[model samples]
Target: MSRLLALALASTLGPALSFAALSFAAPLHAQGAAAAALPKPEYLTVEQLRAKYRDPASRFMTIKGVEVHYKDEGPRGAPVLLMVHGSVSTLRTWDATTARLKTRYRIIRFDIPGYGLSGRISDEVAANVQPLDITEGLVDALGVKKLTFVGVSSGGTMGMYLAAHRPELVERLILSNTPSDPVKYDHLVMPQSFIDATARTKANNGFQDMDFWNNYLSYFAGDPKRISAKTRAEYYDFNRRVPEKYPIALVARIGDGKQATIEMAKVKAPTLLLWGNADPLLPEAAANAITRYLGSATISRVLMNDVGHYPPLEVGDRIAQLIAAYVEAGTPKL
Candidate 1:
């Protein structure tokens, strides 16, 4: 059999076995050896990433001493939607949703400093400037008076922070697959099974391999077959380019997150828990827990079946429709 077929078969055998361990034809074994000899993935400089990925809508500005990459699109005078992407994701995560909603609302999305084309967030920058400060500064720099905040995964945590601390700036909120109380539900969110798989896969395959990302994305997806090649390639490329410090920084930042129940009580905006029921990271119980803390806000919950952690990627059009309706009606009907 061909090397491609052999590799494809190996992917089904679970994380315990490495590619080199697969017993294939002599020719395929030699090919696998050749593949293993390739150099490891290298980090891309901000300038290089920008030149390679930036589009006409791309805009750059310094927020709290960190140079930020963002896009402000759609009608200038329209109701604004401020979007924040989750870890391991860039602003482009909203591409499909933005395409559908931008015609009606002004959509603003930014790379959350440590990821994407945003400037490298060194230890010095992270120490001196908080994530919330960067977000607040970005909106202030853009001259936005009020916005509907939309966040996915950890980005949703940031949204809750803003809604609690900077309530005046947030008109509405939509959080997808977000952890309400990590301190309380850490086990449910990051199960040992997932932790073990992650450690094992990274140790064996490393970040440079396409199969690594394929497995990573697949594990997060409700339906692995639904993931597109284009999506896989984008994820693989971005992961390979991100700074070495990102993983640790993200973990530390999440660990430092505020007490959710205390913070969510301060939010006054109409909030929607738009989540995927099949999400392994934040289960339905976690999504329901958010409602308990959001006592002060008008809350709505919609859990879509067969969708995963990343709703924008898994079901963008549906997300866009819900967001548009929620923003217009001032309450979610979903």
Candidate 2:
């Protein structure tokens, strides 16, 4: 893959690519030694996934016609924090951050439809919403009158739309490794090596080929060796659990996202924007676009050194602290 394509994919598709994993089948076979060492993707039953990925607090409920898999944790009546992960990421990606802040805040995270334990989008009334509308439906169903959002990448794009439209429900916002606008295929050009996992995903009915899963995930982490065994297991496990049709469906919407034209000016909630200095995906132009639209006092920008796309994975503790401070500073003291 060219450097530009990789950066664009890493920036725009950060978490979402988990929805889009290994279809690649034969490219690495030529490197016999390397190919022999890669782990094969394991296909798991829904039952198997429930056992492996389940947290005691995790629950399932039907909302708007779709089975929503979510976890609502921490003290009741405390400030609510809704975590929206980017593509390819499930609620589990926030496990580290949840643990860090659960004592002081209630955290809610769920799998977006087409990913994780979430099923297809409903065609019925209220159940048919995608992205922001889907987020509002889920939040309204949860009866959270007031809440904050921590959205990553595509999740960030979703939150931007939600906050812009539903400023009343969203109290504050934190967008990490995020995009102000939905990225298109033109920005996220994919070469063959990038989709080598496509065959793996299709062949296994949407479960990634283990070798392909590892490679695809390694891109987000920026180094394969740095990813932990537990993290690797979690990614592979969840990818296998997602229904094949959703990811396949995304193949058609490659250039699209929920964010059409970002009206950051329409957003009223206080927002924090974060990015890695090393992040290749978001060029200064794209990042500045949002900044230009929002009022200065309503938004704050922070850049991390030596980090890549996934900050919660790379510096969960720092992010947890930053969020805690941001929320505390903005919220009234009880």
lDDT of 1 by residue, 217-291 (tens): 776787878778988887767766654453333321334235656787899888988888887656788777788
Q: List the global CA lDDT of all models.
A: 0.71, 0.63
| Model 2 per-residue lDDT tens digits across residues 1-334 | 4443343344324337322332323333423433443445556765677776677787887765667788899998899999987756777778788999999998989887666766654345233445555577778888899988998766776676677788788888788766555443344433355455443343343345555556656655534465677877777677666354444331112234333344466777888876655454554455576666555327777777555567777677778988998898744332
| Superposed model 1: Cα runs more than 4 Å off | 1-39, 183-201, 204-208, 246-258, 330-334
- Candidate 2 segments whose C-alpha is farther than 4 A from its true place: 2-42, 121-127, 182-207, 222-226, 248-259, 283-285, 293-297, 330-334
What is the number of residue pairs that collide in model 1? 0
lDDT of 2: 0.63
List TM-score per model, in order: 0.80, 0.77
